[model samples]
Target: MEQSFPALPGQAALPGLRHRLSTRIVSLSLGALLIVLAMISGTLWLSWQLEGAGAAINDAGSLRMRANRVAIELARAHAGERHQLDAQITGMDATLARLRQGDPARPLFLPDDPGIRAQLERVSHDWNQRIKPSALADLGVATGEAPAYPAALAAFVDQVNRLVSMIEQENATKTTLLRLSQAGLAAMACMGTVAVIYLLYIWIILPVMRLQDGLQRMAAREFSLRLPVETRDEFGMLADGFNRMAGELEGLYQDLEARVAQKTAELARHNRDLAALYDMAALLNMPNDSEALCRGFLERVMQQFNADGGSVRMIDADHGQLHLVVSAGYSAALEEAEHCMRVDACFCGEAASESVVLIEDLSKGAALSAGRPASDARFGCAREGFPGLAVFRIETQRTVLGTFSLHFRQPLTLPASDIRLLETFGQHLGVALDHLHLSETARQLAVVEERNLVAQGLHDSIAQGLNYLNLQVQVLEDAVSRSDMDETRTIVPLLRCGVEESYQDVRELLLNFRSKLAHGELRQAVEDTVARFRRQSATELALAFNDAQGGPPLQPEQQLQVLFILQEALSNVRKHARAGHASVIVRNGRTFSMVVEDDGEGFDPMEPAADDQAHVGLHIMRERAARLSASLRIVAARGTGTRVELILPR
Candidate 1:
């Protein structure tokens, strides 16, 4: 398809005419024309010779007539008409001269053959040497002295007959040559036209077709096409140009394709990284224990990076040790050895100093690359037959929480994106662990608060009851010591009523202390409290739960506070309110609100507690409300029922 234009060493140089296609076509056309013209000229030359031969033949025949006239004129001269005889002899000589020397204007000539010329010369020799002189000498003598004029005339006429035959023979030969030249000219025209057309096709048509095909291929994005440069002409140059352009376009297309592919791969990788980060974040956010969370995270990380072994460790800052929270694909021995390393101890410790440590080829034993101490113990990952390792610090913005590691079975290099993603995973793990710690701390704090409430309740209700019973017993003892039967009956009934009232208070306190919320369902906890309060007391209680504003649920701690506050309010109604009926309404929305109303002989809002029970219960409810960062409003009057409403903001 492709060819070099310049000739190689020792090769024949290309013809200069080859460079100019038009010139070559013109030259070929002209050459064909020249050949046809040459053929035509040859035919015309032969035809002209034949034409002159016809004239020569005609003139030679006339010489016979003229010789006859000269004989007749000689006879007349013998009859004493000598003047006409001279004129006749002059005309005959002139005819012989005209036959000897060819005339181009009349187209009269003989062929330049020795035999024809000799025949003509014989005719003229007899006329001048024998026939003419005899006639002339006889003309000068008597009629009888015209010696053998008739014989001489017969001889001359025979010689002229020989000359005319020789000229006719030469003319016949020219006619044959003329006919052959005409045939050759016709053949030359046909052949030359065919040759010219074939040359034109070879030089022009084929190259143009190839160029057109090349253009079509290029349009189709087939840049690899190369046209053959068969000539050193304009088409050859065009072919060369086409080949160069195709090569350049092919290179450009390949480069563009490569770049596009590279960008596509990079985009896909970026999406994968983002997906992994999202999945890791979602996994960490689930309500799981720290150990389970770490184990799940480590497993996912291992799967993501194709790690052979991995571990998640948490820092025990109090003891300055790292507790191995979770591990996978590691030997038991290695796990045991690395389970409780000191914070300043192994690869994890080193990683704590550097956020991420990627030892691509751990088999190289390049311990110093991560700036580890020379005296430090050998890495557990290396001991586990992992040839490559990556260590990431589990850290937040404020502190280094722990470290996690991935171990590869073969030497592996992580790209920057992978390293950054791993580091992000570590940060997510650290945040999850921190959240778990906060949740545990909050649980502990709630337990302590519950214990304090229990103490306060016992102090306010049970202790007071026990103290009153003791006084009643002392008085009854004194009355009994007096030994009056009526006094004993009165004191015994009073003691019995007092003991029953104290027993009821004790039962209610135990029930309140045992009250617990199930799974932080604030509405369910409130309904349960209201049901319990209604069962325990004579007050008819109706519960209404409304969550029309639909929003996110409260935190565990917040739910607990709401539940406790509701319980305390309900308890206050049962003990101090002396209400006939009560209503509890719980509403959940962007904010949470609970209202506990009682139709009872309500106490004045501005007055002092008047008793320990009312003051302690009211104080505890307010305290619980305050813990939720909510407001508690108590509406009470001497005649109206009491209404306690707690409101918690978003």
Candidate 2:
């Protein structure tokens, strides 16, 4: 027999219910499946039996008819043979006696009696005494008919009579079998009717009565109602099982009654816990100011968990040590100073390092393990750390942010209730941290974006005005040269140089503000820069840039840094390393290198220029390079010329 069982809760109940309700259902369903199979098999068997019976009956009838016809034809053949024998045995007087004894008026066929022995004797004499035996028979064979012909007629008549009698008897047997088949069919029909009545009582009425009673009782909340155990068969089993289930249901009803109130209390407690967890998470996630959040969360945990003390400790990621940050329910002195102890010495430290909760009994030398006596020091005796505790690791994406521990003064059984509550709080705290991180990022981005907008505004507006001013100065100078434009002539030489200087100052302002003006390809922007430089300086400037198209495009802020470095270096070349022919070549070797080489009176590259010297441009260039994480190298010797190189990370 196939069997099944049911699964219970993870924590074992250890109940001795051998047959669970689920097993009952499975058993019943399987039995039903087997019953259906039996029914189908029985149906098929009955159909086969009936079909076989019909076929056998039809076959028997056919055979009986064939036998009757065969027997009748054989009898007729024997009769015809007897008739042919008459002519050969015409003088046989025994034939008349045999015919008379066989009832000729009624045309009945019967064997000849002893009174007809004449024919037998005659036939024997014809074949034996009437002639010279074989020699006489051979002579007769050459003459006429056989001598024993009349004797054969008696045997032929007997054979014909036997055939007719056998035929009649075979027909009578067929009639008896047909009568028996009808009687058997009637008996089967009666049996089938009785079987149906029994099935209706067992399958329908009895079971329905039992089920109705159970339903009525269940509706009345009398869950302990039971049915009678009638037999050990399926119906009996069903009754016994139903009663057992009812008993279980009664117990379940009671359990539900009690559990409802308990669950209501539990739900209320969970809600409170949820609120507390949310509050703690809010406290933890408020700010990345680790000191404040840890302290606040630690205090809340101590109070919320109803623990004697709590602390949030951080682990030494490298040394595998622990450091207590926020501790509550301890001496203010210890908590304030942020007491330091090796992970091996501190209780919380050791607990965190071990990655387990410490539940000390605090008997004998248990407190002395930390070199503290096992008595309440506050009560003028040694006091140990909390008796029972739980430690949880505060872990995040990159590092174990810290560990939090709750300490109970007494040995407390830490229930799953509090554990789940605390874990949910921890999760919410983690989410809060993520939100804070996003806020910080958004703030930083806003600052950067603000700076970029400010830079662009100054470039587009102020720089354009300066460029126009510089062009106007040049136009004034050209007009003065072409003709005596008196007013232009008067002001041109006096204001011309100063105007150009003013334009240069504005250009410097624009460069600073326009650093964030990137809206297209970086190299194309660089090309534009080169073109602008050539236009502004109005000198032969050899510009070359290698890999200018390939470096990760610099941010607008980084672009501003690059532009400043360029401006400062080029300004220095113009002022100190003066050369008619100059080159600004951007070379990317190990890093991005920009070198401005000019042929001019050279100076020591390492030493600063004299106080009176015009190397302030160089100083500014170096400062800009420092800000950009770029290296500034000044190569200048007496008359060989100079090269100012600015290098930034690739």
Candidate 3:
């Protein structure tokens, strides 16, 4: 038999905890208010009963006194003392009327009891019939025959005494009843107060204390604490809710701890992957031959994946063939036989053609190793003695570089994480190869451009000077052929001067080609050139550099070009422009500007004379400026000074 337990109180109660709590609070307050109101009503009723009893007692005493006074007045009148007998009679008459009408002033308090009314009626009758007549007679006003003298007084006193006794008895009874009612009400109110307090402690105060204790425990991270659910009320529902919340919080905290641990492990794994990739990149960047780089990369891959052997094979796009660049853990005969394969031949070739990773379980005896000639070479699976193989494509954005194949002795299954690592490694290798290729191409281009610049420089300076020297020699030859002695002598000195000038030009060209500014410091080079020009020329040179100490430094190539342009401008100024003041201003900012000005005999730049030596210098300066990716502007006139400006992007 399955034993069942009762459900916790108010676990699934309707209207929720808030509504139930409000209802309970309202009920308790109303109950307490009703009890208080009942106590107040009981006290008021008792007071009213006591007040009526006191009034009745006082009326009884007054009735007795009035009766005694009537008796005294009757006695005095009988004794011939009738001075105030009439006044006494009137007073007694009024009291009798009040008793007969039951004191109409107290309407809700009528003396309607038969015994008391009868007694009061008798007193009134006696006073009117016997006492009044007797008193009137005594006062010397005869209306009727007077009755017996003290008999009427004795009857009236007896009746008044009876009425007083009845009134006292009623007062005593009411007093006792009022006292009992008060005691009963007080006792009931006290008992009710005790019951309400006990109930409040059970339903409200105890639950509240328990909730407070639970909250304190929760604040201390004791999420397992719970309140007891004892009744189908607000407190019980609250306990249920609190227990549920604690359970959920405990579960969530445990789950959070688990997730944090899992994520930490994942992060550690990722860090190891990154460290390995960084090591591979450093190895690839070293100045090693292609075969050495491949060999090192294969070793790392084998170590990273716990594989037995691996090979890096590159695709010859033009030949449509796969050439094994490097290999590991293979016999010499097998390596020679499998060193190269066609693009569509085997698993590696398939990976290259499809540009996807390929896996093969050689233990299944698949056809991947087919079509190979049977020989002692033992190519493919037979040669490698590996049960499983994986081939990954090494590619970039659009170009397929090659294939990397790894062999495992046992049948291997790759997890997503390991597969992702392999893919990332392939990407890094492909990009590294591309960078090396680009670097080699750039080196070759740089060499070719340097050779072209040297050829042009020689043609512009040394070759031109030699041409002039040849013309001068031809003139000396013509003079000697004519036998003109004076002309011949004149031609000889001109020839000597021409030879010296050509030699100097050759020297200067060699110096210009060989000159290498220290670390390509354009400003220092400019200052040194200016000092040299000042020593060699009569012009006063002023150099100004504004905001040139900040901003990004220019590239080495750009700085060299700017230095060369400045040197050319100063050279033209020295040889042709006989200026007194020359200034060079270089400003470095978001853009670079170099201004070379001279106060000299300047010529129109737009239409320079064909024989002007400055023209060649200006052409060279413009060529250097073009290489700097800058624009050159020359402002010169016959009379005005010359200003050359070069603006380059920073």
Candidate 4:
């Protein structure tokens, strides 16, 4: 008893059947519209393209005709030059014939013959210095000047003939363009036929088919059905009118689309803003590390635009310098993408000067007005990133802090929304960077406070202890019996030694505490030390300093560490490697290295480190080297002598 009351459904089938018939009619009509529209549009577009192509062909043909005339002129010019050469040769032949005649009935009238002789000499000189030199390979003379240079002249003639043949070949190649035009014309004929067939479908066959389907569906009493295609001309106007009638019957079918699309746009905007906020949040958390934040900004810009090469160009407008603050790029694309400029010079400087964004197509465009575009290829993608590049300036109300750039391997237009996203990213990044700078300033203040506390503690505790100990030692010295000379002397020496060691430790501690002041002047100090040592030394010492600078300077701790290493090296040279001369060099650069060479008794450089006493000097040098972030090298042999080297990287 599943409910068997289905007999009334027979009437429902009438309505359903009519609906199906109407749907079929509408489907066929829409299909006819799409098919005919595509054909008509494609045919018209292709015909227009072909017309432009034909015009271009005519222009090319005109150029070809001009080139052919130019070739003929070249032929004439060559012939004229040839005649001039031939006349000189014939004149020479006539002179020889006269000389062979041996009719020297006089001095051959030497001066009278001078003019003719001079002409021959002049031709020969021109050939030797100019023509013969151009035909040097076949001259058959080792020297540049050669008489009777038939070999060279023959070579020149062969070259001219080859050139003529090459011109003929070039002309033949150009004739291929005309053949192309013929092929194009044939193609045009076929295109016209396709265009006519397309027009026929649009005007007649498709319309008849649509009318038949519409009448059949109407006969089924499906008044809700109508033609689905709209048209533009007379036929289109009729079709559109019919479609409007259909829309009336099919009420509300496409109405929901507009509302749904608008709703989607609202949702997408929220998501985009959310994503941007999340990116900004990550930067804000890393307040102390400005470099990380800057890199993050660079990475986001890279991600947003798919950049291949980029840099931070800092503002330096006051002094004409667009310093490349920081650059990131791939190794392979370096030659194309690298931005190398002195710290005091770059387009970023101008950008900062005017406070504007600079965009350039280095491959195609020239520099601009608001800022400098140092051939945009400076921001070009590596082999991996090259199709194009883009730049953005990071700015705020305060000033133009710097510029950023984006690059892509292919040309692309960054959409308006994308540009807005980039601007937002840059603005937030600039703010984050500003925060980082403030944090660093705070950190420095904290460090100063701590150092002051340490200084006060040293004065109140360690110094007072030493003072009290000194007073006790003085009292002990005064009370000691002078007559018990040996005992008094022993106590005095021990006390004096203790005092001296304490003084030395205090001096070292003070120096270490003052390290912050030496920002990047280590090499100058090291060089000064070397110079002083050289002044005292009797031997010659040559320096090859690698000029490393602008990096964080060596702290007082590091300086002391390096000083100990030098002392150990000098001591080793004095005791074990006995020699008459020595040289110490400290070289520095982007990376620091040093060599202390001496011509003394040499020993095997590669030896066991466990032999502590034999390598006492080595141990001291290496220990000090490790503390200074340096390397110590001992080069020695049994007889040839030894060279000690110490390299410190600071």
Best by TM-score: 1
Q: Predict model 4's lDDT versus the native.
A: 0.53
Per-residue lDDT of 1-650 in model 4, one digit per residue for the tens? 11222334312112233223344445655665675566556555444433433333332233223323333333343445332333433443443333323233321211123433453344345444644344333223344444333434444334333333433343344345445555655675577567657766866678778877876775674557766455433444445555665565445435555667877886797587668668666755655465566677677667655677566765555764455555566554463334444332334444243332544444444334354545434443423445455566666657556667665656546665676666666666667666666678887986775455455435533565477578757766675734566667766766776676456445544543444325456566556556644654454556565555544445666655565555446545544566667776665555556667777777775756454445545655676677566777777777676676666654
Clashes per candidate (backbone, < 3 Å): 0, 5, 0, 14
TM-score of each: 0.62, 0.36, 0.59, 0.33
lDDT by residue (1-650, candidate 1, tens digit) is: 33335766634344455366777877787887788788788878887888888888887888778777767776666666554767777887887787788899988778889999899888888889988888777766764553666777777778888888887888888788888888887887788778878888898888988889899989999998988878777777678878988988999999999999999999999999999989998999899998899999998999999899888888888999989888888788888888888877644344345567444466776643455532222345666688777777898887889888888888768888888888889888988898998999999998898788888888777777788778878887888888766877877787787788778778877765666555547777777677777677888999988876786678766877777777777777877778888898888888888888988988897887666565887888888887778899999899798999988888
Q: What are the Cα lDDT values of the candidates?
A: 0.79, 0.56, 0.73, 0.53
Off by over 4 Å in 1: 1-33, 55-164, 182-313, 323-342, 347-353, 357-371, 379-392, 396-398, 404-432, 442-571, 578-638, 643-650
Selected candidate, larger TM-score, 2 vs 3: 3
Clashing pairs in 2: 375-382, 375-383, 376-381, 377-381, 377-383
Task: Please name the candidate that would achieve the greatest lDDT relative to the true structure.
Answer: 1
Model 2 worst lDDT window (10 residues): 373-382
Between candidates 1 and 2, name the one with more favorable lDDT. 1
lDDT of 3 at 547: 59
Question: What is the per-residue lDDT of model 2 for residues 435-542, given as tens digits with 9 covering 90 to 100?
Answer: 666787998986785465444434433454466567767777687778758867665665666566656756755665555556334455566666766666644678
Off by over 4 Å in 3: 1-19, 66-166, 169-209, 231-237, 331-337, 346-355, 360-385, 438-650
